[model samples]
Target chain A: MNTAILSGRELNYQYNRSQRQPEGGKAALANLSFDLFPGQFLALLGPNGAGKSTLFALLTQLLRLQQGDILVDGTSIRQARSAALKSMGVVFQQSTLDPDLTVIQNLNYYAALHGMSSREARARSLVELERLQLGDAAGKKIRHLNGGHQRRVEIARALLHRPRLLLLDEATAGLDLETRANINRHVRDLCQQQGIAVLWATHLIDEVEAADQVMILHRGNKLAQNRCEELLLEHHCDRLIDLFGRLTGTQTGELTT
Target chain B: MNLATASYCFLGIFKRELHRFLQQRARFASALVRPLLWLLVFAAGFRAALGIAIIPPYETYITYEVYITPGLVGIILLFNSMQSSLSMVYDREMGSMKVLLTSPMPRSYLLLCKILSTSLVSLLQVYTFLLIAALFDIVMPASGYFWLLPAVLLASLMLCSLGLLLSILIKQLENFAGVMNFVVFPMFFLSSALYPLWRMRESSEFIYLVCLYNPFTHAVELIRFALYASLNLPALGVTAAVTAVLLFAAISAYQPRNRPQRGKPPS
Candidate 1:
């Protein structure tokens, strides 16, 4: 398989704090670079306002690239955005589902947006729902589902396109610890089983496992990128919590797991 | 985008809009009720007071209800277009618009599909109003029913484009209600929808001139002429020109380079 499914070089973005002062803006993302090979689970660790979502926005072409470029399987996101986006799927931090729409309808609509035929979309939707143990809930409206279930349905919808690269932004936000851990496991297993590269962005440190590749983003800059275990050892910390606290300038008070 | 993909995207968006329209019973009710009230109650009250002379389409003086039926249809189209724009604003706030923008299709195609879908729904609302108008004994030539479809479609596109342009100008969903009132009410009253330009000229030449300049006047005239089984060349020409210009502007507003940043952090 082609190893590097996604890569970015010198990605940069800045937002004007005040419209009147054009020069008075802070860099949201600065000179960041990263790569993800096929079947790898890469964790993007950042606190709030650390520019994790900004990077996702750049990758998804929701925000125009101010500088540099991103490539999906060697296809340039800037030069050929459509072709680059065709192989990727995204789960935003906020709920994007139509609350009035049934789960099946939502999945089919997304599949159609990805250019899948109705029959193929239905089949893939069923398979994805089954994978998420949501087959029976397919007929239910999204408003009726719990927060965790809704997120699962969103994941199913995202995967219906069979994207090789999955970009998830705070996918487990607002869920209980057990539900969050279960979702983390499910996505991790999806990475290994489907051989799809996953970039999971979150502020939670416990979600990162020892084997996953970790990229610590702080204030629009990449502080470190390495295997989670090696990073912990290099930082001289027993737990990722302490390491993350040190990097983000916050002290860990309580550990969940 | 390829033909197959384009067709799929169009169908998907169109179906979603249709389903949403169907599910919102209150929207459907209000959309129909507003125009019907104008035809039945407002026209009834004004029938004795206003006098419409021998219009070109009519050899004899016509009832006031018949005179304003075409205008009410215009009202339906105008309100529906603005309502759909409100949906676009709501979609942006709810994060669904992001999902739509991320599609692999060209941005122009996606936005066009969105505008066209809303136009299609507005067309349905137009026809429903017309059907109710006919049931009230305010009938037109049978051929007008068929020809009015294309006229309504064109008018809907023009009005939908105008709504989209306003949506782009007005940033927030919360502000949409105020904008809708300012735009929809003025456009409807300033045009020939409620009163003829000639009648307005009798009262105030300036308002008559304003009505002449209003694009909604041409839209209503286009449907009026089509309903009479005749073509109004100037109305058709102006409506088509306005549609092209506004559609271009709307598309430009939605382009990624022109898309405005919502909050401090990107999502």
Candidate 2:
């Protein structure tokens, strides 16, 4: 088998007492492990408070790992943080784009952060922006664009460096149906065409396709890890939502009928 | 990374700050107006009550306006540094900070670049204030204007570091108002920015002691000396040492292990 581009080994994390508003020092994640190879899309399926974001935080180095190790393209994040971060691009759940700057301007700023030369930054920014169908709106301020377009700008920014891995933290949390599908299709196409490994986290069942790899998490524990169709076949369930309901013991509101 | 990459990163941050600063027209106007008011109104009103003395940095007896020019410059640096750091808190809440932290560079280096960018922004306002002071005939020695550049920049970096340390401690935007009242006021009022140490000693020995201990006092003294094309060794030593400590401390506060307790629940 080809070496996995992303490897998360026995990952564990817990919130401390001071961090607890009501529940303190509970395990936010427990002995979770996963791997993704190039051109693969792994849908991290979980509801609210299921430790999806906590795992994302740890993977992105936003939160330091309490226990376990994350290796991005063979570099341990703990041992070589800069090298580990260098191999991946991330789209945070919250909008990180500057609203006052134009869409292209935002891309250019991120290009600089990645240490890309001005010539390369402009060239890559245009390619990504056009691919995402954001070319015409390049000069428009971020505040002037709709929520979906802003998210697309963010995706374009993340891709400017052409990372081996792409991490999306609820990239479609709040969006119209058509926009969500458009983003979903775009990310999938990127994974296929560029051979980029994708770790997509979401609570929505529809976001997970039948052929995609899926990991079901509940209360910081992995309930299942397999292809969507395989998991459904193994559980004797007809739909992904039914399988999720059986595992997490809770119903999610974002299911697409 | 290489020097070319590092330099571009700095340029990117500088460009972004420049854009934001230019867009906020009121911010520049307000920064100047505060110091100008003190130089024109408060200094004029206090000239009759406060007598001038030939301080170490001053050659002879000087007017109240000349005496307090550096102090007004201190006020500008103090306020601007705090305001710039306050934006960090805003950025953290608004999520832009994550973008910065995620850069494929050392976290400490990224933060230093951030502080440097903001300090550069504050320096612009400082120079503007100095220019206006010069127009009002409150000019420094000829080379003093040039000398003030490095002196004020060092002073500005120290103040920005202290403000960044405070920003890490302060969790919410609502609580930053308390910093203005507590941190800014105490540093400005308890320093030689407004009165001489001897004069302060006459009023209360405790206040005098506090003024001597405050880092802002050393920063003001440094600026005062540099503006006259002279260097105060002791003041320079204190200001530089404190800046190193505060900057190191601020950078440590962002490191993964020491990062302020992030108990935010998973969304």
Candidate of highest TM-score: 2
**Per-residue lDDT of candidate 2, residues A149-245 (tens digit):** 9999999999999898999988998899899999999999999988999999888888899999999888899999999999999999999999888
As for candidate 2, its clashing pairs are none
**Candidate 2 chain B: 10-residue stretch with minimal lDDT:** B258-267
Instruction: Count clashing pairs, candidate 2.
Output: 0
Give the per-residue lDDT digits (tens) of candidate 1, residues B92-162: 77888887888888888888888889889987888778887777888899999888988999999998898
Error of 1 at A248 (Å): 3.9
Candidate with best lDDT: 2
Which stretches of candidate 1 lie above 4 Å from their native place?
A: A1-3, A17-23, A252-257
C-alpha positional error of residue A24 in candidate 1 after TM-score superposition, expressed in Å: 2.6
Q: What's the distance in Å from true for residue A151, model 1? A: 0.2
C-alpha lDDT score of every prediction, in listed order: 0.87, 0.87
Report the error of model 2 at residue A250, Å: 3.0
Cα DockQ of the candidate 2 complex: 0.63
